[model samples]
Target: MEGLEQWKIQAEQWSQQALQYIHQIPPNQLYAALAVLLFPIIFIFFVRLFKRTKSNTIILSGLSGSGKTVLFYQLRDGSSHQGTVTSMEPNEGTFVLHSEETKNGKKKPIHLVDVPGHSRLRPKLEEFLPQAAGVIFVVDALEFLPNCRAASEYLYDLLTNASVVKKKIPVLLLCNKTDKVTAHTKEFIRKQLEKEIDKLRASRSAISAADISSDFTLGVPGEAFSFTQCPNKVTVAEASGLTGEIFQVEQFIREHVKP
Candidate 1:
């Protein structure tokens, strides 16, 4: 009992000393120190709460003949094999990017799907969209102008899909096959698609169906359409599967899918 009393007395003395030291500091300085200590804790809590699981599936979609298959083969094998055949079925695979493979060993693989541009097979995309880490919408830059409206329509439908909007799925408007000198620039294609979508938005709104399944909408109300208005991130990049100039496409994939 005596030894316990002695230890308690020592603890009280040390506690008093610590309190004296804390009280000696200015109130403002104490508050500043407490805030500095708390900031990281608060920041970490929010990050954990908001951070989503890293999805491994990356979707590659676009109109037929936009070279989605070529890009897929290029990503998987680092080659176009000098030709391609359109598959009406979804070309799905999980493999490490051939571009990232090194002398040491294979890098992390991704679930990539080349959904046929044909309307009949495009529905297969829904099966994977919920798990998609990112989506690459390939555009045939060489024939952009001729297919601009169709491309825009397809893109609009995609952006408005509930899966994409609710999950804030990032979409890369990848302009492919840029090796051809006559191919359009990414900037030109983005603008044309935006303008086309704006017109479609107005026309679609006029014929209101009470049963119209509402998904996400495009652009600001009463304002011109642009990618910035999207709730999800939308970006445009250029690539050429023919010449293997696909750095930006690979970058986009790694940015969202990792490794």
Candidate 2:
């Protein structure tokens, strides 16, 4: 009888231990399950938030003799210089551009990047171009006739080969040094660009027709070719040889890229 009583007490203790173990399992499993499931959800939420918050970048590119540096400084601090190149590295100085744009009646700030124009620094430019929401191509207006062909060729290649910038990137062409005598007017520059575009079309036609050995000598019809003016926010002005035109360039950028 005594032995039976002792056995009963031992059985009660074992049952209590079993109950405690079972209770512990559920809470531990609940936490473990939450950890496994909630991790991915939290990660995705943060990733989306970061992507939404990312700032847009704008890249400036042009020839060595072009006023890329002068314009960059002017755009940044209203400082102007003639016949000089910017020797700074990427991300240097107060390169951040802030502006206000009405989006659903709310204003936002946008970031812009001023890229180097040297051919040797092209790789660096390529890296930044993909991130740019737009591009500004500066041309020396006074040297347009003499340098138009080369400038256009370089511009075409840069615009065509860059997979990221080719299709959707908006490009603005600024005819610099317009304040000088003999500097082509905006209309004249547009006309010259139109002619170059026609030449490019003709070249493409010839290349395409050559594939089947067809008549590749067909000329591009002048009527079929049209000049679509890059959306102009400001008039071209003389940037060098006297008088400051930096403010004009800054105003144009401000008009387009509202941050």
Candidate 3:
């Protein structure tokens, strides 16, 4: 009982000292000091209360004949925009997906950009990476073998880009043109790409770090390269952009870009 009473007296004395010190300061100075101390607390509270908004941009990219433009039109207009030629420039638009147009509620529009596959036009992809919610690399499934190396190299570069790796942006390896009976399966295309990438990874890692242009590296050091090994979410899906059978593509967009 005596110890408890002594502790209470000490607490009261500290409180009195604090009150005395606060009173001694002039009103203006006191207010300034209080404001300085409270500013950061108030700022932090507001920051937590209002979280950053997610980006609604999605990038569609791939080789020239991979049907990226077709997919873009299909998503926007539900038609193949007949007589579409190779896009020398990016085809971009912000709109609600055609598939969702019939839905009961309103849908959030996505800003979709299809960066052309031409070698000279490839650098434009960097301009959009910062705001991209996800990236879709369309592969020509019907012509997978002949273009596997080129596709793998492009994909390796994309997977190693500084923005992509640092942001951990999701990537969809879309094997397009699955409507044809002869079109390769997504699994086969995935495995071949992995094998090709594994070889590329080995050769690239042999170069001196100073000479390496890619901002990041891919796969585990000692194991074969696999999509699962990517730090970012890498997934494979089949689609036929020419036939408007792009349910998987729509699903990927909806997964990253909220309604």
Misplaced by over 4 Å in model 1 are 1-53, 103-106, 211-214
Model 3, 181-236: lDDT tens digits are 99999999999999999999999999999999899889999999999999899999
Q: Note the residue pairs that clash in candidate 1.
A: none
What are the models' TM-scores? Answer: 0.78, 0.59, 0.84
How many backbone clashes can be found in candidate 3? 0
What lDDT tens digits, residue by residue, belong to model 1 across residues 1-259? 9999999999999999999999999999999999999999999999998895677899999999999998898999988866677788899899988877774764678989998999788789889898888999999999999899999988998998999999999999999988898999999999999999999888877767674454767789899899889989999999999888999988999899776
True-vs-predicted CA distance for residue 154, candidate 2, Å = 1.8
Which residue runs of candidate 2 sit more than 4 Å off their true CA positions?
A: 1-51, 86-112, 162-167, 204-242
Task: Give the count of colliding residue pairs in each prediction.
Answer: 0, 5, 0
| Most accurate candidate by lDDT | 3
Candidate rank order under TM-score: 3, 1, 2
Q: What's the C-alpha lDDT at position 197 in model 1? A: 92
Give the Å error, residue 233, model 2.
12
Query: Which residue pairs in model 2 clash with each other?
Result: 99-259, 108-259, 109-259, 110-259, 179-238
Pairs with backbone N, CA or C atoms under 3 Å apart (clashes), candidate 3: none
